[model samples]
Target: MLKELDPLLHSQLRLGVMSLLMGAESAEFTFLKEKTNATAGNLSVQLDKLSEAGYITIEKTFRGKKPLTRCRITRKGIKAFEEYVQALKGYIK
Candidate 1:
């Protein structure tokens, strides 16, 4: 069933993350956490899933000795999101 939709872009949090990332060049972990209203642990898990699926990239860096996590959606992710929207529209009528 998910295949009919976009397999890579169906989960709620994942979709939310991708949607936000798609609109920006990149976004910070805290920004996505706030926007998705997800706990850090949950967000981290979801991010790992996306990264493993090759749908998004996660970069960890340091800012003044503090660790920072940033995210960006891959081109494959963009295509998946587009397809997911199209699939949803198919049922809208």
Candidate 2:
């Protein structure tokens, strides 16, 4: 049987976010939006879901006059991503 995939990370947008986070210290809302080509509303919702799961942390602050939202992956997220990759290997015949 195929190993179960992580429902949260299984999403194209969410997976993209996690993948990008894995490469950087943190990522900004607009950067993720542009890279994922996702709407602000949809990205916000997905970010909230990831935050609720404790996989990532969201920090909100004002950068000068503009609101800044940055996301950082947590240890839990790294572990989950690693496991997800391992599970995916099961699909290869």
Candidate 3:
């Protein structure tokens, strides 16, 4: 039997976010929106889901007068993503 995929990361948008974060310390909301080409509302919802799962951290601050939102994957998130990849490999092989 194939291992189950993580439902949260299974989402296309969520997966995309994880993939991007895997390579960076963190990412800005605008950057993610641009890279994913997702609308603000949709991206915000997905980010909230990831945050709620403790897979990622969402920080809100001000950059000179502008509100800034940055997202960073936690150690738990990295581990989960790795496990998800291993499970996917089981399906391929």
lDDT of each: 0.88, 0.95, 0.97
Residue 23's lDDT within candidate 1 is: 94
By TM-score, rank the candidates, best first.
3, 2, 1
TM-scores of all models? 0.91, 0.96, 0.97
Q: Indicate the worst ten consecutive residues by lDDT in candidate 1.
A: 1-10
Model 2 poorest ten-residue lDDT run: 84-93
lDDT string for model 3 (1-93, tens) is 999999999999999999999999999999999999999999999999999999999999999999999999999999999999999999999
- Clashing residue pairs in candidate 1, if any? none
Range of the 10 consecutive residues with the lowest summed lDDT in candidate 3: 47-56
**Model 2 over residues 1-93: C-alpha lDDT tens digits?**
888999999999999999999999999999999999999999999999999999999999999999999999999999999989988899765
Please tell me which model should have the higher lDDT, number 2 or number 3: 3
**Residue 22, candidate 1: how far off, in angstroms?**
1.2
Which stretches in model 2 have alpha-carbon errors above 4 Å?
Answer: none
lDDT at residue 60 of model 2 (Cα atoms): 99
TM-score top scorer:
3
Candidate 3 clashing pairs, residues 3+ apart or interchain: none
Judge candidate 1 against the unseen true structure and give its global Cα lDDT, from 0 to 1.
0.88
